[model samples]
Target: MRTTGGQLFMLVVINAALLAVGAMISGGTYLSPFNLQSMAGQLPEIGFLAIGVMLAMCAGNGGIDLSGIALANLSGVASAIIVGSFLSSTDNETAFSIAFIAVALLTGLIGGTFNGLLISRLNITPILCTLGTQMLFTGIAVVLSDGRAVAVGSPELLSQIGNGLFLGVPISFLIFVSAAGLIAALLKFTPFGLWLMLMGTNPKAATFAGFPKARVLIATYATSGLLAGLAGVIIAARNVNVKWDYGTSYLLIAILIAVMAGVRPEGGYGRVICVVMATIALQLMSSLLNFGGLSNFVRDFAWGALLLTFLAVGRYNLVGLLTPNKSRKLV
Candidate 1:
């Protein structure tokens, strides 16, 4: 498990290819400050979901997060409805904001919790369990909205937080950094992180080693759900209205980011930094494409291509990524 620059180089190549194609589709320009800023704003929610999914994707554990999009849409709609119904424009803003955060966080937590329970206790396949939840969340959202979008008030406040800049940095970017830092500390410094990954890589051995497999699996799913909820809230905050399919578009990209972020679908291998960098690269690539006037769909295809390529690399061990390295990657 040695990490090497060559392995990292593969990631770079993937990124460069994505950037080049995105630019081509976008019609030329591939770099822009505004686009970077926009990507910064967009990444947090996507990053959150991607990271959430990554935690549970432990290899040999046969787990994956296919329901994040559905969970996000459901949790977001739930947040808006709960907050909007309870607090009017006339109510105290302080209480309203607190309530908003709580409701949103709780909705996501519950979705995640349910996912964990089903996978751990019921012994359902992660894919099947999450698929069920995904359907449940999406269906609930549609039913709640009656196929209509519910508009929220005081978008200015939400915008201020969602679209805010602090010390010339996007608040959302700062949040992603902070979140990654916290998780990195846990993963690199704490035993729990190691154990959780251990569960993913070799569940039979993990059980032999006395790890609580079910709890670990459940917790990972729960954490993923929580992050998805956070992303849901952020996206909902950005939109003036909450719709049933709010996160439908992000589902595929989230999976792409999770894979590119270095989460081995086999379960036990991946990095948050992988998620962050891959996501950033995509963000940058898409921006470059837009600036160049490339068709959005074409830029999207670039991403699809990137996913296909890396997946091949992963499966075939074609690149040096699967090899041991001289220098170890930082935790």
Candidate 2:
């Protein structure tokens, strides 16, 4: 088994423990089919953002995408204005749906391209670039909507995508799973993935070996932007409106999920499977807390505490300390 498998196992154990305790406290309401399905429906939005965070972390260099939720909001706002102008959701459902999705994705791609150009070509630091872009995206969104939420009206097809189920699984969750699978394959089987990992692991070695750093960075960030766009679509689908300030806490939560998945901050190594498990683990924990009648503020505090604990463990190599290597031959 790979290192990811061990990490995944730990996450699974955490998830199970949370579920068991939740069930005990909630008198099995937590384990009911309805609650499980609700959890599945809730997973995709954050999962998509977390994947984008994972990609940036995998690229190293203090890499992170603070702009993901901002860009996602921008994408949704732009889509609503553009799609709503030409087509009525009630009278031209098909055309409106097609145009809505296209505009959302295109907006996301363009925003992502902007980030890639600044970071890859201009040599801006990833964190700084994304932070600036996050504000820029939010500004654009606020100006476009005049700081108010733009309502999408929950069109039939959009609602189905957001809340519908097929074969006893939420469609949004399936979409999340599909996206995760594609990313896993991209990282495992493709030359770009190899170059990316190598670049993150040892930038000097990759540069010396003639790797195309610009192309890799551009593609990686663009892909991250695409994911953000998809997340925007889902967010709009689930909610009746899109606003600049919506999901204000999402950026931090996404980063938390990536870190919990053990994505290295200095770059080089991350696993999509581990990220998937980490996401599920988090959702379970959040649900468990909710079942326990905890307020959202408490939940946020708990998430922050957990994030700090994990970061400290990683920083101090606590796993190494707890499970000393027996292969040292007594030093």
Candidate 3:
């Protein structure tokens, strides 16, 4: 397995290479400030979802959150409807925006908590549990919105969060970086982090050691849900509306990001900074595809290929296979 530092270095190299190629191919359009800002603004929603996937993968027991994007869309749709019922964005823009954000976050928390409960309390497989909830969330959102996009009227604060900038950096991107930093800190400095790692590494050992296994699992999924909630807010801000089926391909892309970051599928390991770097690299690649005038279908095909490549590398220890073993002597 590659160390987190190795993963970071590899991602940095990939990003630099992509930038150079994009500049050459696009005659500098790809390197322009406008394009860079556009990529930065667009990546946060997927970045948030990728981080959530990372958390779920780190919890072990075939853990994975398939419901992240679904829950995110549901968060936006539910918050818009709930907030719109009692407040008008036209008459109370600021308050309505604040309430919408608050409700979205709260809904995400509740939805995640429900998932955690099912998995931890009932001992349901994480994959199956989240898959079920994914459909459940999507169905609820569709029913509530009646298959229509719920418009979140342009409120000052919300619009700024989605499209505004601070110190020449996008506010949405800044929020994502801040959240990643906090998650990194939590993982590095807290007992919860230790418990999660240990639990994933050796569930029986962790249980015998008296760690609160169920609690850690619940917390892990809950944090993932919170991140999904935040992503929902960003989505609504960027599109100025929420729908039941927004970002249909995001779940797969998010999973690809997590896997590329070297998060272990069977659990026990993940790194936030690595995930962030991987997200940037993938975003650069996606932008490069756009510069090349490739169709969306081609972009999807490339992403799927990259995902399968990484999965093969991890599954077969392809890196280890290629590296000469110092301990082995040529006979």
Q: What lDDT would each prediction earn against the true structure?
A: 0.74, 0.86, 0.91
Clashing pairs in 2: 60-267
Please write out the lDDT profile of model 2 over residues 167-244, one tens digit for every residue. 989999999999999999999999999988888888889889999998998888898999999999999988988888
Supply the global lDDT for candidate 2: 0.86
- Lowest lDDT sum, 10 consecutive residues, model 2, at 322-331
> Which has the higher TM-score value, candidate number 1 or candidate number 3?
3
Model 1 off-target regions past 4 Å?
A: 2-32, 89-91, 155-157, 318-331
Rank order (by TM-score, best first): 3, 2, 1
Clashes of each: 14, 1, 0
lDDT of 3 by residue, 1-331 (tens): 2444555666777889999999999999999988999999999999999999999899988999999999999999999999999999888989998999999999999988999999999999999999999999999999999999998988999999999999989999999999999999999899999898878888889989999998998999999999999999999999878999999999999999999988998888999998999999999999988887899999899999999999987676554454435222212
Runs of candidate 3 with Cα error greater than 4 angstroms are 316-331
Q: Give model 2's TM-score versus the native structure.
A: 0.95
TM-score-best of 1 and 2: 2
Quick one: best lDDT, which candidate? 3
TM-score of each: 0.88, 0.95, 0.95
